[model samples]
Target chain A: MALPHAIMTALLEDDMSGYELAKAFDVSVGLFWRSSHQQIYQELHKLADRGWLQCATVAQAGKPDKILYTLTEEGRDAMAEWVLGESRVQEGKDDLYVKLYNLSEDNANHLTAEISRRREHMMQRLYLYEKIRRRHYANPVSLPVRRKGVFLALLAGIRQGEQFLAWCDEALAMLGTIDEPVE
Target chain B: MALPHAIMTALLEDDMSGYELAKAFDVSVGLFWRSSHQQIYQELHKLADRGWLQCATVAQAGKPDKILYTLTEEGRDAMAEWVLGESRVQEGKDDLYVKLYNLSEDNANHLTAEISRRREHMMQRLYLYEKIRRRHYANPVSLPVRRKGVFLALLAGIRQGEQFLAWCDEALAMLGTIDEPVE
Candidate 1:
């Protein structure tokens, strides 16, 4: 999907500078989609050039002038059309599984290493999810009063991370038994 | 990180062809890292050229010859070093989040439409995960008992998919509330 489509859609909700847009992405829709700062800047220019987004130069003290971006009428129409055309399946493109599938001959040690790496990685995610939950509980948003959805999504992230960790434990045990060859 | 590094690491575990690697990535590591078929193919060539990987040409009766890749000592060393390196935090680079971060000023109706689109997506994932689970339960692999680690990883995939689906439901509810704001 074009970055401009998502970018313009977000702008239709509120006006924001590029920096703020980047931050907001991390908190919300970021669960599925992502972009780099450079990519964001590029998309912003493309959207504005295409007349889908309007930019107003706002003066700031000390810092350079910020360009505040908002969606135009055309942009809204484009975003609406894109939303309606959205599909049901979001197929992820990932790499780790590819290595696992190409199992030529069994090497128990390599498999063990991979499992160990994944376990550590899941632990890190669990920690991060916990932090997000704590932040939410401590400073509840006055806006979005019905924020059960956000909470649920965060919980899902935490649970999924924990689930992987548990699986790692089971996998490690299974691997241990395999490593012990019968005489 | 470089695609070659990731691919080489996978080879260190076991040898695989380019096509097999592509499919495996979809099922396993797709949760964290992503790679394109083109990138994987390119990496194979590069690695072989550098003597890090050697390709054995296989003769097929009626099909094109396929090159099976195995790691060299240098490739194994590279992968070992990479595996021991400090793992970086998984950054939020999703395009969907970038879009949402810019949504505060958007038309509520449009945003709601997008949320609904995402909800349908989560349901689709739920269905796919269930199918995979059923397949495994129906015909369990005949490998030694110790081989359950592979299945454990598969189960992890199903759970992660379900978690995302649950989160989508919550997000939909929040979006619905915002669509009809209280005066």
Candidate 2:
């Protein structure tokens, strides 16, 4: 359900071939709304069937026909109406927390190592988010209305990424207090 | 798969009837790892079938027999091995982000109001998380090994709750800059 809306939001940028949209999703939209390429293609067909998207096939002289999708008026109305609706707080089902709940002195090292691995992943993502911020959001407060929405979404990612990384460091420190020296 | 592990983690505190486990999950463990009561009951059956849990039926006079589940030695082994493994960062699929991406002056109020509602919900959760921190973690650094894990998990909730609230405020501020006053 969210995936269809996610695809529609991406189409707000411009009409895109399914392949181009998938690429765009991976590079940007996927950062906020994770969707597999296959899911995107499948949703594209469904959206077109529902008349949320208008699809066209363009023949080429020397290449295979290109399929493109554009948001229909109905799609824009759907997206607009959706904006007014309540959004569920997508609670993260972090297995790490469940793993931590089972922790004892005997297995502390394993969870600690896992936290370190997670920290690296968080660090790399924080770096990517910041890069996007610097490149696109110099004056986010001044961007046009729709662009401001994009900036706000990116800001959500940056703030959460920073906090998540900080929590990793804090978790390691707390674990250190009770960690036994390896023999 | 995670629900099974999540159930095992809950059982670490004590063996419980499925009813008690479901209640416990709703109040505490569900905060970290969310699952429906139906899903929890289903996973309990699956785990018992896999020999990770032992289900015993104890008869009560003039009442239905109570079915209790205890983590087996194999369950402990599974939990231990699972702790060493990697955990995926459960990136929240926040539809608000997609809604934001479609922002325009016409629909600005709709999204702005949606954010306000989200902020209130987030504030209430943050307050609850803080309440738990105060009640259990008087001296987090000195807690026993296993208890330290519990504190850390709660700290994750507290930390993320605070950050999400901050982001909501920042988002509103950014939106405020361009919002047209309704006549």
User: Which candidate achieves the best DockQ against the true structure?
Assistant: 2
Evaluated on chain A only, model 2 obtains a TM-score of 0.89
**Which lDDT values do the candidates have, in the order given?**
0.62, 0.84
Poorly placed runs, candidate 2 (over 4 Å): A59-65, A180-183, B59-65, B180-183
Could you tell me which 10 consecutive residues in candidate 2 chain A have the lowest summed lDDT?
A174-183
For residues A77-96, what per-residue lDDT tens digits would candidate 2 score against the true structure?
98888877777877768888
Instruction: Give one digit per residue, the lDDT tens place, for model 1 in B84-106.
Output: 44444344334343334333423
Candidates in order, TM-scores: namely 0.63, 0.92
lDDT of 2 by residue, B72-153 (tens): 9999899888887777777767788888888877777778788888889878888887887888888887777787888888
Q: How would you class the docking of model 1?
A: incorrect
The CA lDDT at A94 in model 1 is: 34
DockQ, all candidates in order: 0.22, 0.75
At residue B10, what lDDT does model 2 achieve? 88
